[model samples]
Target: MTQKKDTILSREIGKLGGFGARLVAGLLPKNIFELTIETHSPPETALEKAFTILSTEGKVIEDRRIDPNKPAVCAIVGSGLGNLNPALVEVYVVSTKENITKLVIIGTAKEGLIKQYAGEKAARRIADLLTQVLP
Candidate 1:
């Protein structure tokens, strides 16, 4: 079977403000990350599903919200344990083909997070977790 392109790495996600900003922030690389899902699914509804997925790991630091310009767009913010700052990284979710979900996580580190987490293999890890988290 052909390997699927992680939606978080897709061009469609770059179109999002959060994703676009993260990309420019150098927190993630273009090829390293893409939208694992892209569809008409709104961010609010999508976030409900995403939070369910995130809950599988543990409680998130904050609630979800939609991008003002992209209401359908939603993001989850929380911090990783043991990091210098307790602030959570941002993870964005969007809808895609076949009802699958797309996942994009912004590292809170801002400087080394991408280098540490945005690698090819890291993307796969994030994708797999996202797949389990979303419907």
Candidate 2:
């Protein structure tokens, strides 16, 4: 996955989407990351690949489409120490340009006060791992 510090995306995410910045808002402590990958892959193909990659490193609890008509999937995976760290990942596939598909990934996880450091790190790790598998 390509890493970027996209100011435009940051702005749009804060002002747009039905989420209305709720997903991007900071409350207490939150670990969140987003990735946009362009490929010529199908939505289900990318979703399956992400699930397989995450499963190798963690236990995937949920893998389902957010809506029947939308090319989006939401999955939750747990890893590390009896699955103490769990990550919620949302992937949206969009057709960009002529034939390229752009996969938008949003991942989030909570930071527990008891093990504050571990929680955030593990959560981001899950996001990083999942990003590598996006088609």
Candidate 3:
């Protein structure tokens, strides 16, 4: 009987710990950030440049056109300090006007108590790279 009671108590404690962890995660802020810039290159050219630039930073997980008449979107998983600090990046290339392309980069990372700014940092780095290379 004592053994059964101990097992039950341990299970309940495990459940409570899981609940607390989930509660804390729900209360934490989402680690998402975005940066936008305009370049003189056309939409297709800008997107190609973005892919080339971001591929150097990390693996380009996806590259596709959402719609025939809409902007193109690219997804990248940026390499960070290690495997635990990967940043997810989404890049959208839009044609705002003739010969003007707007690139929007959104980056997000797993929310943690110590590294909340990882996503913003990654996004800024990617934007800077694009700005320097895109023309």
Candidate 4:
């Protein structure tokens, strides 16, 4: 599987955040959060487990291997619509060693300047869910 192209909103947000972060430094707070965990399972198995875990939480929007030759690296993106401000969760799986896999789960949400906790809340929710089930 190949990485899916970013949605228009996502692309624009990336541009805005990238530029804003650099231009204003701390003005636009970070909207992305990442959590990493190591699993004893192989990459493929780990990815499957992660998919199942995420599916229960929300709709999985995209899933694909990063490279055909390196199937050990893959990603899954999901959307959680339970909140008024929806959040996107991206999970990346990489094989680091024999029988060892690393799972990087990132949660991103749009936030307002005055209220900047949405992103962190989304990230922490996904992190807790995955941590309780992944390992």
Candidate 5:
């Protein structure tokens, strides 16, 4: 008998690096509770890049497996993100079977780890960067 590859609902959070962070920074939302950054790239390829980028800056806090039935799932404790005051952000990658990928970044002006980050400026920066990063 051969071992089967575990279906990775969500890749390890530590996988993201600077490049992935840069990709995320490019797609985050500024003035909303949540925003989705969409891309044509396949989920596997996009996630691989994101994981590499995240791993470079922050350590992984949570790595939850996603449900394949759902078109989108959340990537929690992603790197050192999703907070304000201290200015951290929680990054989420949403993918569809159609091959449309999105980066769901949530944050606010509050402090502490659970608080949200990302202002209008940050969202704009993320959007601008996305245009450059995604193919």
Candidate 6:
């Protein structure tokens, strides 16, 4: 994922790697969070657990599964905002031939300053719930 050079996040990521002079016309700022969880489970099992947790939460909105092969789901939740908030949390359970499975969770805030914070918080909640529920 790429960040806008003018934004604070882009400047920070830029320090790690120099920015490529790209136009900002179609660029959108996204606050992303990632986690890799080690589990001895299948993608379906992990996806089920995450779906249950998010669906049970009242804050969750637009909760839907993106894919089952990779077993990914996304939801927009009330991380201090209503349905209109762009704060999105996406969880993916990826598995290889081995028994190990990697659960990746990402939070995206497409707009607003406070929404960015909300996106982070929403991501944390999803990760925490998955950790507590999944084996």
Best model per TM-score: 3
lDDT of 1 by residue, 1-135 (tens): 022223322322243346655355444333233435433444565666655554553335455454553222122222223322111224565334565545465432222343433333333433456555444
Model 2 is weakest, by summed lDDT over 10 consecutive residues, at: 1-10
Query: Which order, best to worst by TM-score?
Result: 3, 4, 6, 2, 5, 1
Higher-lDDT candidate among 1 and 2? 2
Q: Give the per-residue Cα lDDT of candidate 6 at 105.
A: 79
Candidate 3, clashing residue pairs? none
User: On residues 20-127, what C-alpha lDDT tens digit does candidate 2 reach at each position?
Assistant: 443543332545667667666566676667667656654454456434555555545453356544545555665555666676666655443554343345445644
Better of 4 and 5 by lDDT: 4
Error of 4 at 74 (Å): 9.9
Per-candidate TM equals: 0.36, 0.50, 0.68, 0.61, 0.43, 0.61
Worst 10 residues of 5 by lDDT: 1-10
Q: What is the lDDT of candidate 2?
A: 0.52
lDDT-based ranking, best first?
Answer: 3, 6, 4, 2, 1, 5
Candidate 4: give its CA RMSD in angstroms. 6.6
Error of 3 at 17 (Å): 20
Q: Write the per-residue lDDT of candidate 4 for residues 16-102, one digit (tens) a residue.
A: 456553344323444667777887776776667667766776556666644444442222333334354445666677456876778
In model 3, what is the error at residue 33, expressed in angstroms?
0.6
Off by over 4 Å in 2: 1-28, 59-62, 65-68, 79-83, 113-135
lDDT, candidate 3, equals: 0.63
